[model samples]
Target chain A: MDINTVNSLSYEDFVQVFGNVVEKCPLISAAVWSRRPFTGLSDIEANIAEFIDSLPRSGQEGILRCHPDLAGKDLQSGTLTRESNEEQSQAGMTALDSVEISRMRHLNSEYKKRFGFPFVICARMNDKEAILRQLSERLTNERETELERAIDEVKKICRLRLYNLVLSDTQNKL
Target chain B: MDINTVNSLSYEDFVQVFGNVVEKCPLISAAVWSRRPFTGLSDIEANIAEFIDSLPRSGQEGILRCHPDLAGKDLQSGTLTRESNEEQSQAGMTALDSVEISRMRHLNSEYKKRFGFPFVICARMNDKEAILRQLSERLTNERETELERAIDEVKKICRLRLYNLVLSDTQNKL
Candidate 1:
């Protein structure tokens, strides 16, 4: 759909379509619906980011917590939201071997223990190697720094999702 | 959580926990947040049912469309939403052998072709034998009757989900 079409959506339709642009956090999209007449997809992205920035630490962590871990049990169990599953699969997360899977699980658990949220990178932006390297590197950062970095990655994921919704070559069947 | 705890949730937390009570239709939970301070779980369920009944036919169909097909590709590939995956598995959908799977796929597609939505049953309320019987029986139903039947099933599914959220012996960690 075009920006004009997006601009014309009712609150329900907009939320139904763009709701998962921020992973499982539809509340972000539902809240952003009030800021409508978005000039374009970027305007929508900006509004989403602004909302995320305005949240308290707990709320922001809730957003990160909403994300399924890369190569985690959700992936194994096939319960990742569609957006997350595709992104992880594209990043070769679905191809990880036994050792890599165990290592990722250990790292993911440790990271959550430290930060109280999952290690969320934009899986569409990084391959599995880059994701593994970053996971290890970021585990050493201060909590505040990691929080900012993780939310930035969320925006990247959000941007791509917005593109898929607003700039798709064909109409979104959803 | 108890009804008191449930009644105390902010719009975001309420949606986060009870959102999937209607499957992919978090918009329902988002909308229902306006009607909060629910007297108890049954009141919450009543409000949900009322909100659903208030929808136009198209909107009602939209709710049915949000459900995944029983024993379809989502189940086969492990991509069903967590609630749906579990419900389907419990109904023995996950255990369907090759022939049962093929028969289900045929009936599911045919149902969708006729009704413009997947055949939705409360999988937790039916075993495979009953589901198969109902699918065939319901397919012969008129469009309006089928729509009502399908939506009634959605409510049954929704009721169990509400119980899971509100009446669980332990506090919901979500």
Candidate 2:
């Protein structure tokens, strides 16, 4: 995980890391998992660049697939990984906040009905209000447009996540 | 612009590139730009990671700012060196069709009225229909939420652009 080690990872090894994460997170997986191996880090990087480039065309369905349904209060709270849960809490949607919990439920229901999937945003950086606002605004969009926007959003999330994965590996090695 | 050259770039060098872009396109100047020198590539990578981590709570507005007004197609287009123009065009959206061009102009007006800035998406990968779809759908969100989403989107665009900048430098050197 050292910077050198990360930089040195074979394309297969790098793809495996991405595959493992994608296998668990289909949204991200869909965005990147399907791509073929690159010749080198630069090639991998270019693939990423092209993938990011393609996001806007895929639309809302693409975006929503990347997120989990909002946390339900009665639902098992511990289902998410520790890292994901911690990230959720950092964004202030703690499991115990009844108001937020209920709102998330309602929003999730409306969003699913409208878009046919969970309301997805890169939740790592969003707060409840922002999420709500996006949900409300996006609902009004025609399905096709929303789908494209959502996909674009999802790609951004993936890119950020990919950067974090590499950075974390580097930090751990240090 | 080798990897070493990119890695060796002083913070001042990054600022110069960023400032040039910002001077040419003022909308993005409000957002902070930083490149930590000597963190190695990993440290530089971490700087980007932390910057993304610190983005605004909402996703909509943040996403919006990273984009220039669609009508201001000339901003990025005009500023790019000939090689960069070819690169941007290859990603699509350079010569928007007539209907799409008008829609961009129309959306440009409506978006500014709705949110005080032109509708911004990382338009590099999106065609006219996809862009229009997002514009219409995102218009429904409450202002506050839209703002955050926009900011989040912008950060993603910035990171992608940065990666391209770095990778391109590396490729050029090779």
Candidate 3:
């Protein structure tokens, strides 16, 4: 759908259209859908960032938990929400060799076990090695700091996803 | 949702409720939802079986492609739609140790390279070792035979998933 089509869609229709663009946190799209005719991607990104940041810490955590652990269980079955499947695969993380896969599995489990949710990252921004390094390094973080960091990563992910969506819509229009 | 409630859901709602219940083929739920007010699980299964079998060869192939490779990348990211994640993990494929992981990776690539889609099986009914054994063994089948075998496996998966969904709904009522 193009920008005008997106802006004109009913809330429910818009949600169905843009909802999973940012993975499981569809509410972000719902919240921002009314601010239609976004001049471009920046308008959409700013509002989404603000909306997510404005959520209660617990709400933020809930959205964070909605994302899967990096290189975790979703790939084995091709069940990642459409956006996540594309982003992870694009970064080459989905097809990790055994050693990298093992390392990822351990770090993901330990991170979740310690922090109470899966690790989150902007798959579009980082390759497997960077993701692995950060996953290992972040394990030592205190809960509060890590939570903030994860939310920040989610913002980056949402930004990239929105950019891609709008860009795709624009291209399709042409 | 129970069978009765399932009978009442609009086709889209039913699809949302049970679409990926068969992994990636939401259309299966859409196809079967109208034949509802099922007398029992078997009735539902028979209809789903008929719908899938009635499809053209390409339609069958499309649904088959929706499923991920066993022990494939979907596992690493915790991205399997909820039903598939549970099934694969239940059979111990999601938590494979290093050696099994590597073996699965190789087998999955080989199978897909030969057959053109993921190698799928009903993980809930078999242990990971059995899955691995079958994966290795199935690699040598002629393409036509392997496609038939994969569809048979998908039927088994759909049956178990439907049973689990109905059973869970039944239990929830009690």
Candidate 4:
């Protein structure tokens, strides 16, 4: 659906279709439905970003907690949400060897133990190599810096999801 | 879809269709797909139960954690999975007033603090009253007993979900 189609959706339908744009945080979409008559997808994105940004620190952390660990149990068991599965697949996450998988899991566990949330990257925007490299590098950052960086990655993932849904056929870019 | 239709689904399609039968624990469905050519839906149910029973304590707890709290944030914000939304609605969860909602939230929080997982119930089988009562009562149980009880509730929820998906038309039941 394009911008007009998106703008025309009823509240229930809007949430149903766009509910997962922010991963498992469909509350973001549910809240943003009230900000309808969006100028375009970016307006929708802006509304979502604003909603996410406005959350308190605990609320922000809750969003990160909702995300599954990349190439973790969910991926191994064929249990990632459809959106997550597709994003991970695009990043070659599904092709990780046993050693790579174990390393990713170990890094993800350490990251969570330190920050209380997973190491989230925009998997669609980066390959497995970059994901591993960044995971290792980011592990050294302070908690505040890592939180900001992770939320930025969330916004990037949200942007890509919105673009794919609303402008898949168009040449328009975010 | 009927049992024949269910049995014939490709592995990916099978997992996609039944992934959330045990709430967010799609791994159960993914594992059970390998035991296909089922005699009927009960066979599918049996396989799912077997797989769940096979999990270690931590894995079982992980399944419970996958569930959102009843009348919780996801419910209020329209963020529940379609199945969860329907199940909760069937149990009058969406109609909870602010006072009742707060009580449920408070109880859920306390229960989680006690057990480290959300209080899960077969919302399809019980209205808000029963759920509230059980949550209050179950809070007194030992951790081991509560874990077993919670897993039983998960199985009930799974059976109901499976029945709804595969036998929505016929009077034949689980």
- Taking chain B only, the TM-score of every model is 0.96, 0.64, 0.90, 0.94
Judged by DockQ cut-offs, is candidate 4 incorrect, acceptable, medium or high?
incorrect
Sequence-dependent TM-score of model 4 = 0.53
lDDT of 4 by residue, B21-53 (tens): 877555457557657688888888888787767
Clash count per candidate: 1, 31, 22, 0
Q: For residues B49-114, what per-residue lDDT tens digits would candidate 2 score against the true structure?
A: 453344233222222332345545554458543333543465455767778777767876777677
Which model scores highest in DockQ? 1
Question: What TM-score would every model get versus the actual structure?
Answer: 0.55, 0.39, 0.50, 0.53
Best by TM-score: 1
Model 2 CAPRI rating: incorrect
Q: lDDT per model, in order?
A: 0.81, 0.49, 0.72, 0.80
| Fnat per model, in the order shown | 0.00, 0.00, 0.00, 0.00
Question: What would the DockQ be for model 3?
Answer: 0.02
Clash pairs, model 1 backbone: A78-B78
TM-score of structure candidate 2: 0.39
Which whole-number lDDT from 0 to 100 does residue B14 have in model 4? 73
**For candidate 1, what is the total of clashing residue pairs?**
1
Error of 3 at A82 (Å): 9.9
Per-prediction CA RMSD (Å): 10.7, 22.4, 17.9, 15.1
Tens-digit per-residue lDDT, B51-164, candidate 1: 778654655765676677899877878888899998998999989888988889999888877876679999999999999999989999999999999989999999999887
lDDT of 2 at A7: 48
Residue by residue across A1-109, what tens digits does model 4's lDDT show? 6677778785546756787887765556756765678998889999889877765454566567667789887887997889999999999998999899889989988
Tell me how candidate 1 scores on lDDT: 0.81
lDDT, residue A157, model 4: 93
| Higher-lDDT candidate of 1 and 2 | 1
